[model samples]
Target: MKYSTVLSLTAVITGYVLADTPATCSTTGDNTPIKSGCCPRDPSKRLRRSAREIFARTDSPTCPTPKFYGDSCCTHEFAKPTLDKGTFNLQCGANGVADIVNDAVKVEIVGCDTADDLTKETCILQISSTPAGSITDTHLEISTSAWTSTKYPTKDPASWSYTSYCVKTTGVCQVPLNKIGDGASALCDKKLYIAYHTSTSDGTTSKTCTGDGTLIPGQPGSRWWEYLTLDFTCPKTCDGWCCCEKPVTPPPPPPSTQVCNIGTAFGYADGAKNLNGNPVGPAVCDTANRWGWYFATSETSLSGTLIVGAGGNDLTKGTTVGTWSATITGSDITFKYDLYDDNTNGHFDLSSVHVYASCTAPTTCAPGKFTFKDDTLTGSSDTSYTKTFSVSGGTCSTYYLIFHASVNQQIPSTGTCPTPAQ
Candidate 1:
């Protein structure tokens, strides 16, 4: 009995020590290797394991059999991915006076499918939304991927252009929803359609629907969920910038008026006039009230002048013209020229002096005969003489002004030389 008890105690102690031994990698777990240990530690010595692994442990694509070196892992491999995706429609409307654009639905995705799986490969879920028909507007802009309406008489959205925002391969993701605080990243208006795609580890899967209307060129994956237009509050009317609400109608514009500007102008006078009704006083100082100025337009075929302005003064300080203006309002034109000199009424007769002028565009000037303003004679400020005339313009876009003064000179025609005393 004593020998048996001693043997039992030794056996119990041996069994406890064996049970407490440091663990060695086995083919069952992460069948891997270590440099050296109490016994041999080699993956080759491990038993084969059939643990058919998928997007295992890390949710990352891993080899069906992962081997760890005392660590239980080595080798890079891609595991199959299972995708779950959702899509939605575009929603838009008005809140009081402001407008709102919304995603009726969005691309719903649970990219990493397995529990405790972080190693699942990354992929993209693209959703595209577009209108069903063509629309034209002089007040707003609309396209396959964009639409906007502002105001008119400003920048008409008619000419605004854009390219489609498609063909994206982005991988970032979230379980986004268009809830209270959540909003859509894109918008679609009018008769609309939507579609989506879920890419896999190696390539892309088929389409998974989230909204229903008409899915154009539908893409298919072995797995998908379609959310077609179930129930919706279709807009009653379109607004100026929106496809819903009462459409804003623009009023008709008013008629335009005719207008023109001055091109060039001038005036001059050169001839002798009698003073005190007598040609004897210094032979009627040779000169006119206004002369030597030209008014010409840019054209010759037209009859109306370009309302020219002119000013002139003699180098000898004998005469000066201040404030000369020629203007045309509607079909009536008026020319006013003021002459100043020390010889106010000094060498000019009271009656016969007449001013004749005409304006022709492009080439010549027509003649218009008229008398000076009888009310504009003044002895103040060195003989001030002001004359104004009104003329008609025929349909010419351009005109020229030509004038001259030639008081009965020498009379080489009918009058005798030095006046015949007979």
Candidate 2:
């Protein structure tokens, strides 16, 4: 948006009269009254003409005044008819008064004479609200957005000597409804003043009138033709710069769907038990790389299917083949399982290694899906192993775990696996 310097209008002359009493003189002679110029009787009314058009038509030395407002053709040499109340309307959208309160409406003033080239000049348009008999007045500034070049009084359409400006109230403009009247009601029924002025325009050299177009009484360079006063009434409610009622706000969004807490231990379900008779547990010994008995604790209940790759076969194929149990607390989970070796005639290496969980059944534990895995027990007869998982979430429920094992599984010195209930 562009902002320019503003020129203020002063010494406002209020009250509006469309035309003078009809002249009874003839149309062809110089006997026409000097104040009310000569005109043909019964002149047609021209509604909503621009100020420039009204000035030019009334000053024309013709029988029929083209843009006169009433039957009498009053020459505007002394006074030009100011814009009436219906000439301009405030365009508050379909919401009407509600739009004004919300500051969603813009007041546009078009066809305002700027008197000079826009690129070399600055123009100002102002609107003020004053009560009928009150001295308080509030002025609002409007910014110019467009310009047109045209002749003012000449009938030739090709002439471009004078500049006209188009302006509108902007987004940053707000109506102070509380400052207008008594500040207790919703209706802003007050006298409105609309004025337009250019920073460098001279009033005396621009037009041929004395009353509305002449210089203001005390202001040396100010013009009276630049202002139009009328009645302004609307429904609005505001306290200071804010509307009395607030605008409606929109609603918020929904929650997320992730199920895993990524840094805590995965716990066991209620009533989980270990079947092996080693003893209730947390039996500690050397790590799996040394020669010693280490009883893995059976704390967590296995709720999902366990796929064990024992002796080059899936030991999880039958429910009667093996029994497994596990429990987790804090950052550690201990598990142990016992599986019968099907190859009884020949000795085979127990190479069982990794454990994993998934939402569905799988033939092999994939790379990214391994929940608990250890490579130290491969090709060995170690009975106990321990590893830690880093994922955090609710306890295991409605899922499957894949466990790989080998033949001739070594048991702890006491038993194959520990029973946590014992």
Candidate 3:
């Protein structure tokens, strides 16, 4: 049977079929319908409906109807407010934090039919700061009530209406000082989540999106689409907290070029009589009952060796204080000294303290071989003394500091001395 004859029989049976009528359809003998259904004229072609066409029609159409078999497709687009590609700048506030200037937060939106529909939608602007090496972050919402809408239905590129919100002008907005940071020219990580929703009961306001691209906890609906995260480096200079000026960093104060010319070492006596006044034989030079002198270098690690040369009429056995090596030129050097009384009596009767320096190690106490650096009298009430001398070429290098204490009193007849009264 012909295809047209079959389609005519099916169309007559059913009343609601939107597909185009084909030229013919197959039929059986005696004018009875031979085929169960009628297909489109071009089986490969399908019907596609755009948003405009779908909105224009009142009835909803489905594909593959009983009378004719074909594909029907319709597309519905969702709208959300997006940040305009226009300028967005940050300014310094009076509180020394970053703030949004007037009209700085610009949002462009479309697909709103009436002013009431506009009320159902809102765009959010958030400013936040996550300090360096900190996991915690703070957020602040700018005023969206000040958002003023201007429709440009016939714009050059495409039709889009923009809603701009001025932050400083409206009383609703304030500088988010904590979010923008507190110090001078503080840095803030700004996240502007322009969330726009269409549900009237959703109650989605500018606070709905807190710059994290997620709705407020437990709040319903996921219709928000547009989100923009801007990481703008705040400038050092801001014009009343509005526009960003280029940041200028003074070239790190030209690396300290001036080197230390002279190195100084200070020697401090523990007390008038060291060893806690504990009495012992003057010949005893053990760790206990000895006068210790603490030494430290002025210029960080002044490379040198300290030698406690024996002085006085009876003391002879010299001891090495310590040797210091510096990795960096101007490092600090320090050592300790234990002036033990090797004499028979425990009396540390000294005459004078002498500090000498030499480029090379010397065994004998010759004034000509070692250069005399400084001297301090033991009879003085001062318990501290300092030795200032020039280093080799004013650079941190190897040298020797020799300390000699001359004692005038002879050893007592007794083998041990009694502890002095405190």
Cα lDDT tens digits for candidate 1, 1-422: 00100000000001111112223322322442322221122334323323332111122121121122222121223231221223333322112112112332333222322222223322222234432212111111112221112321113222322112223233122312121011121211211112222221222322221223222222233222221221111111101010001224578763332111111222443221221113233211133222233444433221211112222223242222222344544334455443322234222111111333334321211122322224232223322223445433543354444432211111223433332110
Best by lDDT: 2
Per-model TM-score, in order, reads 0.18, 0.19, 0.18
Model 1 is weakest, by summed lDDT over 10 consecutive residues, at 4-13
- Those runs of model 1 whose alpha carbons end farther than 4 Å from true positions after fitting are 1-293, 298-323, 341-389, 403-422
Looking at model 3, report the run of 10 residues with the lowest lDDT sum. Answer: 2-11
Regions of model 2 farther than 4 Å from truth: 1-300, 303-322, 330-332, 339-349, 357-364, 386-388, 392-400, 406-422
- Arrange candidates, best TM-score first: 2, 3, 1
lDDT of 3 at 289: 27
- Which candidate model has the greater TM-score, 1 or 2? 2
**Which stretches of candidate 3 lie above 4 Å from their native place?**
1-345, 358-364, 373-384, 408-422
Superposed Cα deviation of residue 43, candidate 3 (Å) = 99
The lDDT per prediction is: 0.25, 0.28, 0.26
lDDT of 2 at 202: 37
Which 10 consecutive positions of candidate 2 have the poorest summed lDDT?
236-245
